[model samples]
Target: MNDDEKTRDYNKAVAAFAKRYLPYKQPLLKTIENFSPELADVVIRHGLYEIWEEMTPLLSYRDKEIATLAALITDNTVMKEITAHTENCLIQGMSKKEVLEILTVLTLYIGVPKIINVMDAVKQAFENYDQHIKNKG
Candidate 1:
């Protein structure tokens, strides 16, 4: 493929992947549009599509998202983001028990104090997720 063709294909793949992952949350989309359209595009295109597509074969999406959540929980700087990712992991077909297992294992490396603090957030995420499923049903 020529340079132009390559760029076009990449853009197309990115947009498709973004739609799959982020879909259309109007408020969040609006915030991304208003504040950081470029960053948002990169996240949708490069971050989700390109990067994740490459890594997904090595580790499934659920595993990767769970690992990311554990890391974020350990760092304790991005609890909200972690919550979102945990939710995404669920949407992508990870079981709540599996997610909890990942967190349980993470406590070994991340220490008890951090896990203790973040466990509530994780549980709340699961509870909200269950409620959402019930409402959908």
Candidate 2:
């Protein structure tokens, strides 16, 4: 495909993926798109659509989410991503109990300081998810 065609295809793919997996993050996505449309396309197509979409028998979506959450804590990423992934974890059938267990284990490896940040994000994610369900009903 030509440059324009490739950009269009990537944009389309990003939109479809976001609609399915990132419906609640429109404002953040739009901000990135506004700052640098090309960067937004790269992020959506590569990060969310490609790597996140892979779910093999060896690494199911739930496992991937758990891993992602733990890695995010270790890397000290933005709170919004942590919150978003926490929501995705619940959507993928990860119980709150399991999330707690994972976080507890991660504290040893990622340290208490990082877990502090992660816990706040986790709390926000739960609150947001609860509110979202309430609004839907």
Model 1 gets an lDDT of 0.68
| lDDT (10s digit) by residue, model 1, range 1-137 | 57575457456655544433333232564466468867765665466656776546798776777777877888887776766677777877989888888778887887888877877777767776677678878
For model 1, name the residue pairs that clash.
Answer: none
Candidate 2 per-residue C-alpha lDDT over 1-137 given as tens digits, one digit per residue, 9 for 90 to 100: 47786566566656655544445776676787889978976776556645655323477777878888878768887887788888878877888888888888988887888888778889988887788768878
Q: For each candidate, how many residue pairs have backbone atoms clashing (under 3 Å)?
A: 0, 0
**Candidate with the greatest TM-score versus the true structure:** 2
The list of candidate 2 runs beyond 4 A from truth reads 1-16, 19-22, 54-58
lDDT of 2 at 71: 81
My TM-score estimates for the predictions, one after another, are 0.74, 0.78
Prediction 1 TM-score vs. true: 0.74
Count backbone clashes in candidate 1.
0
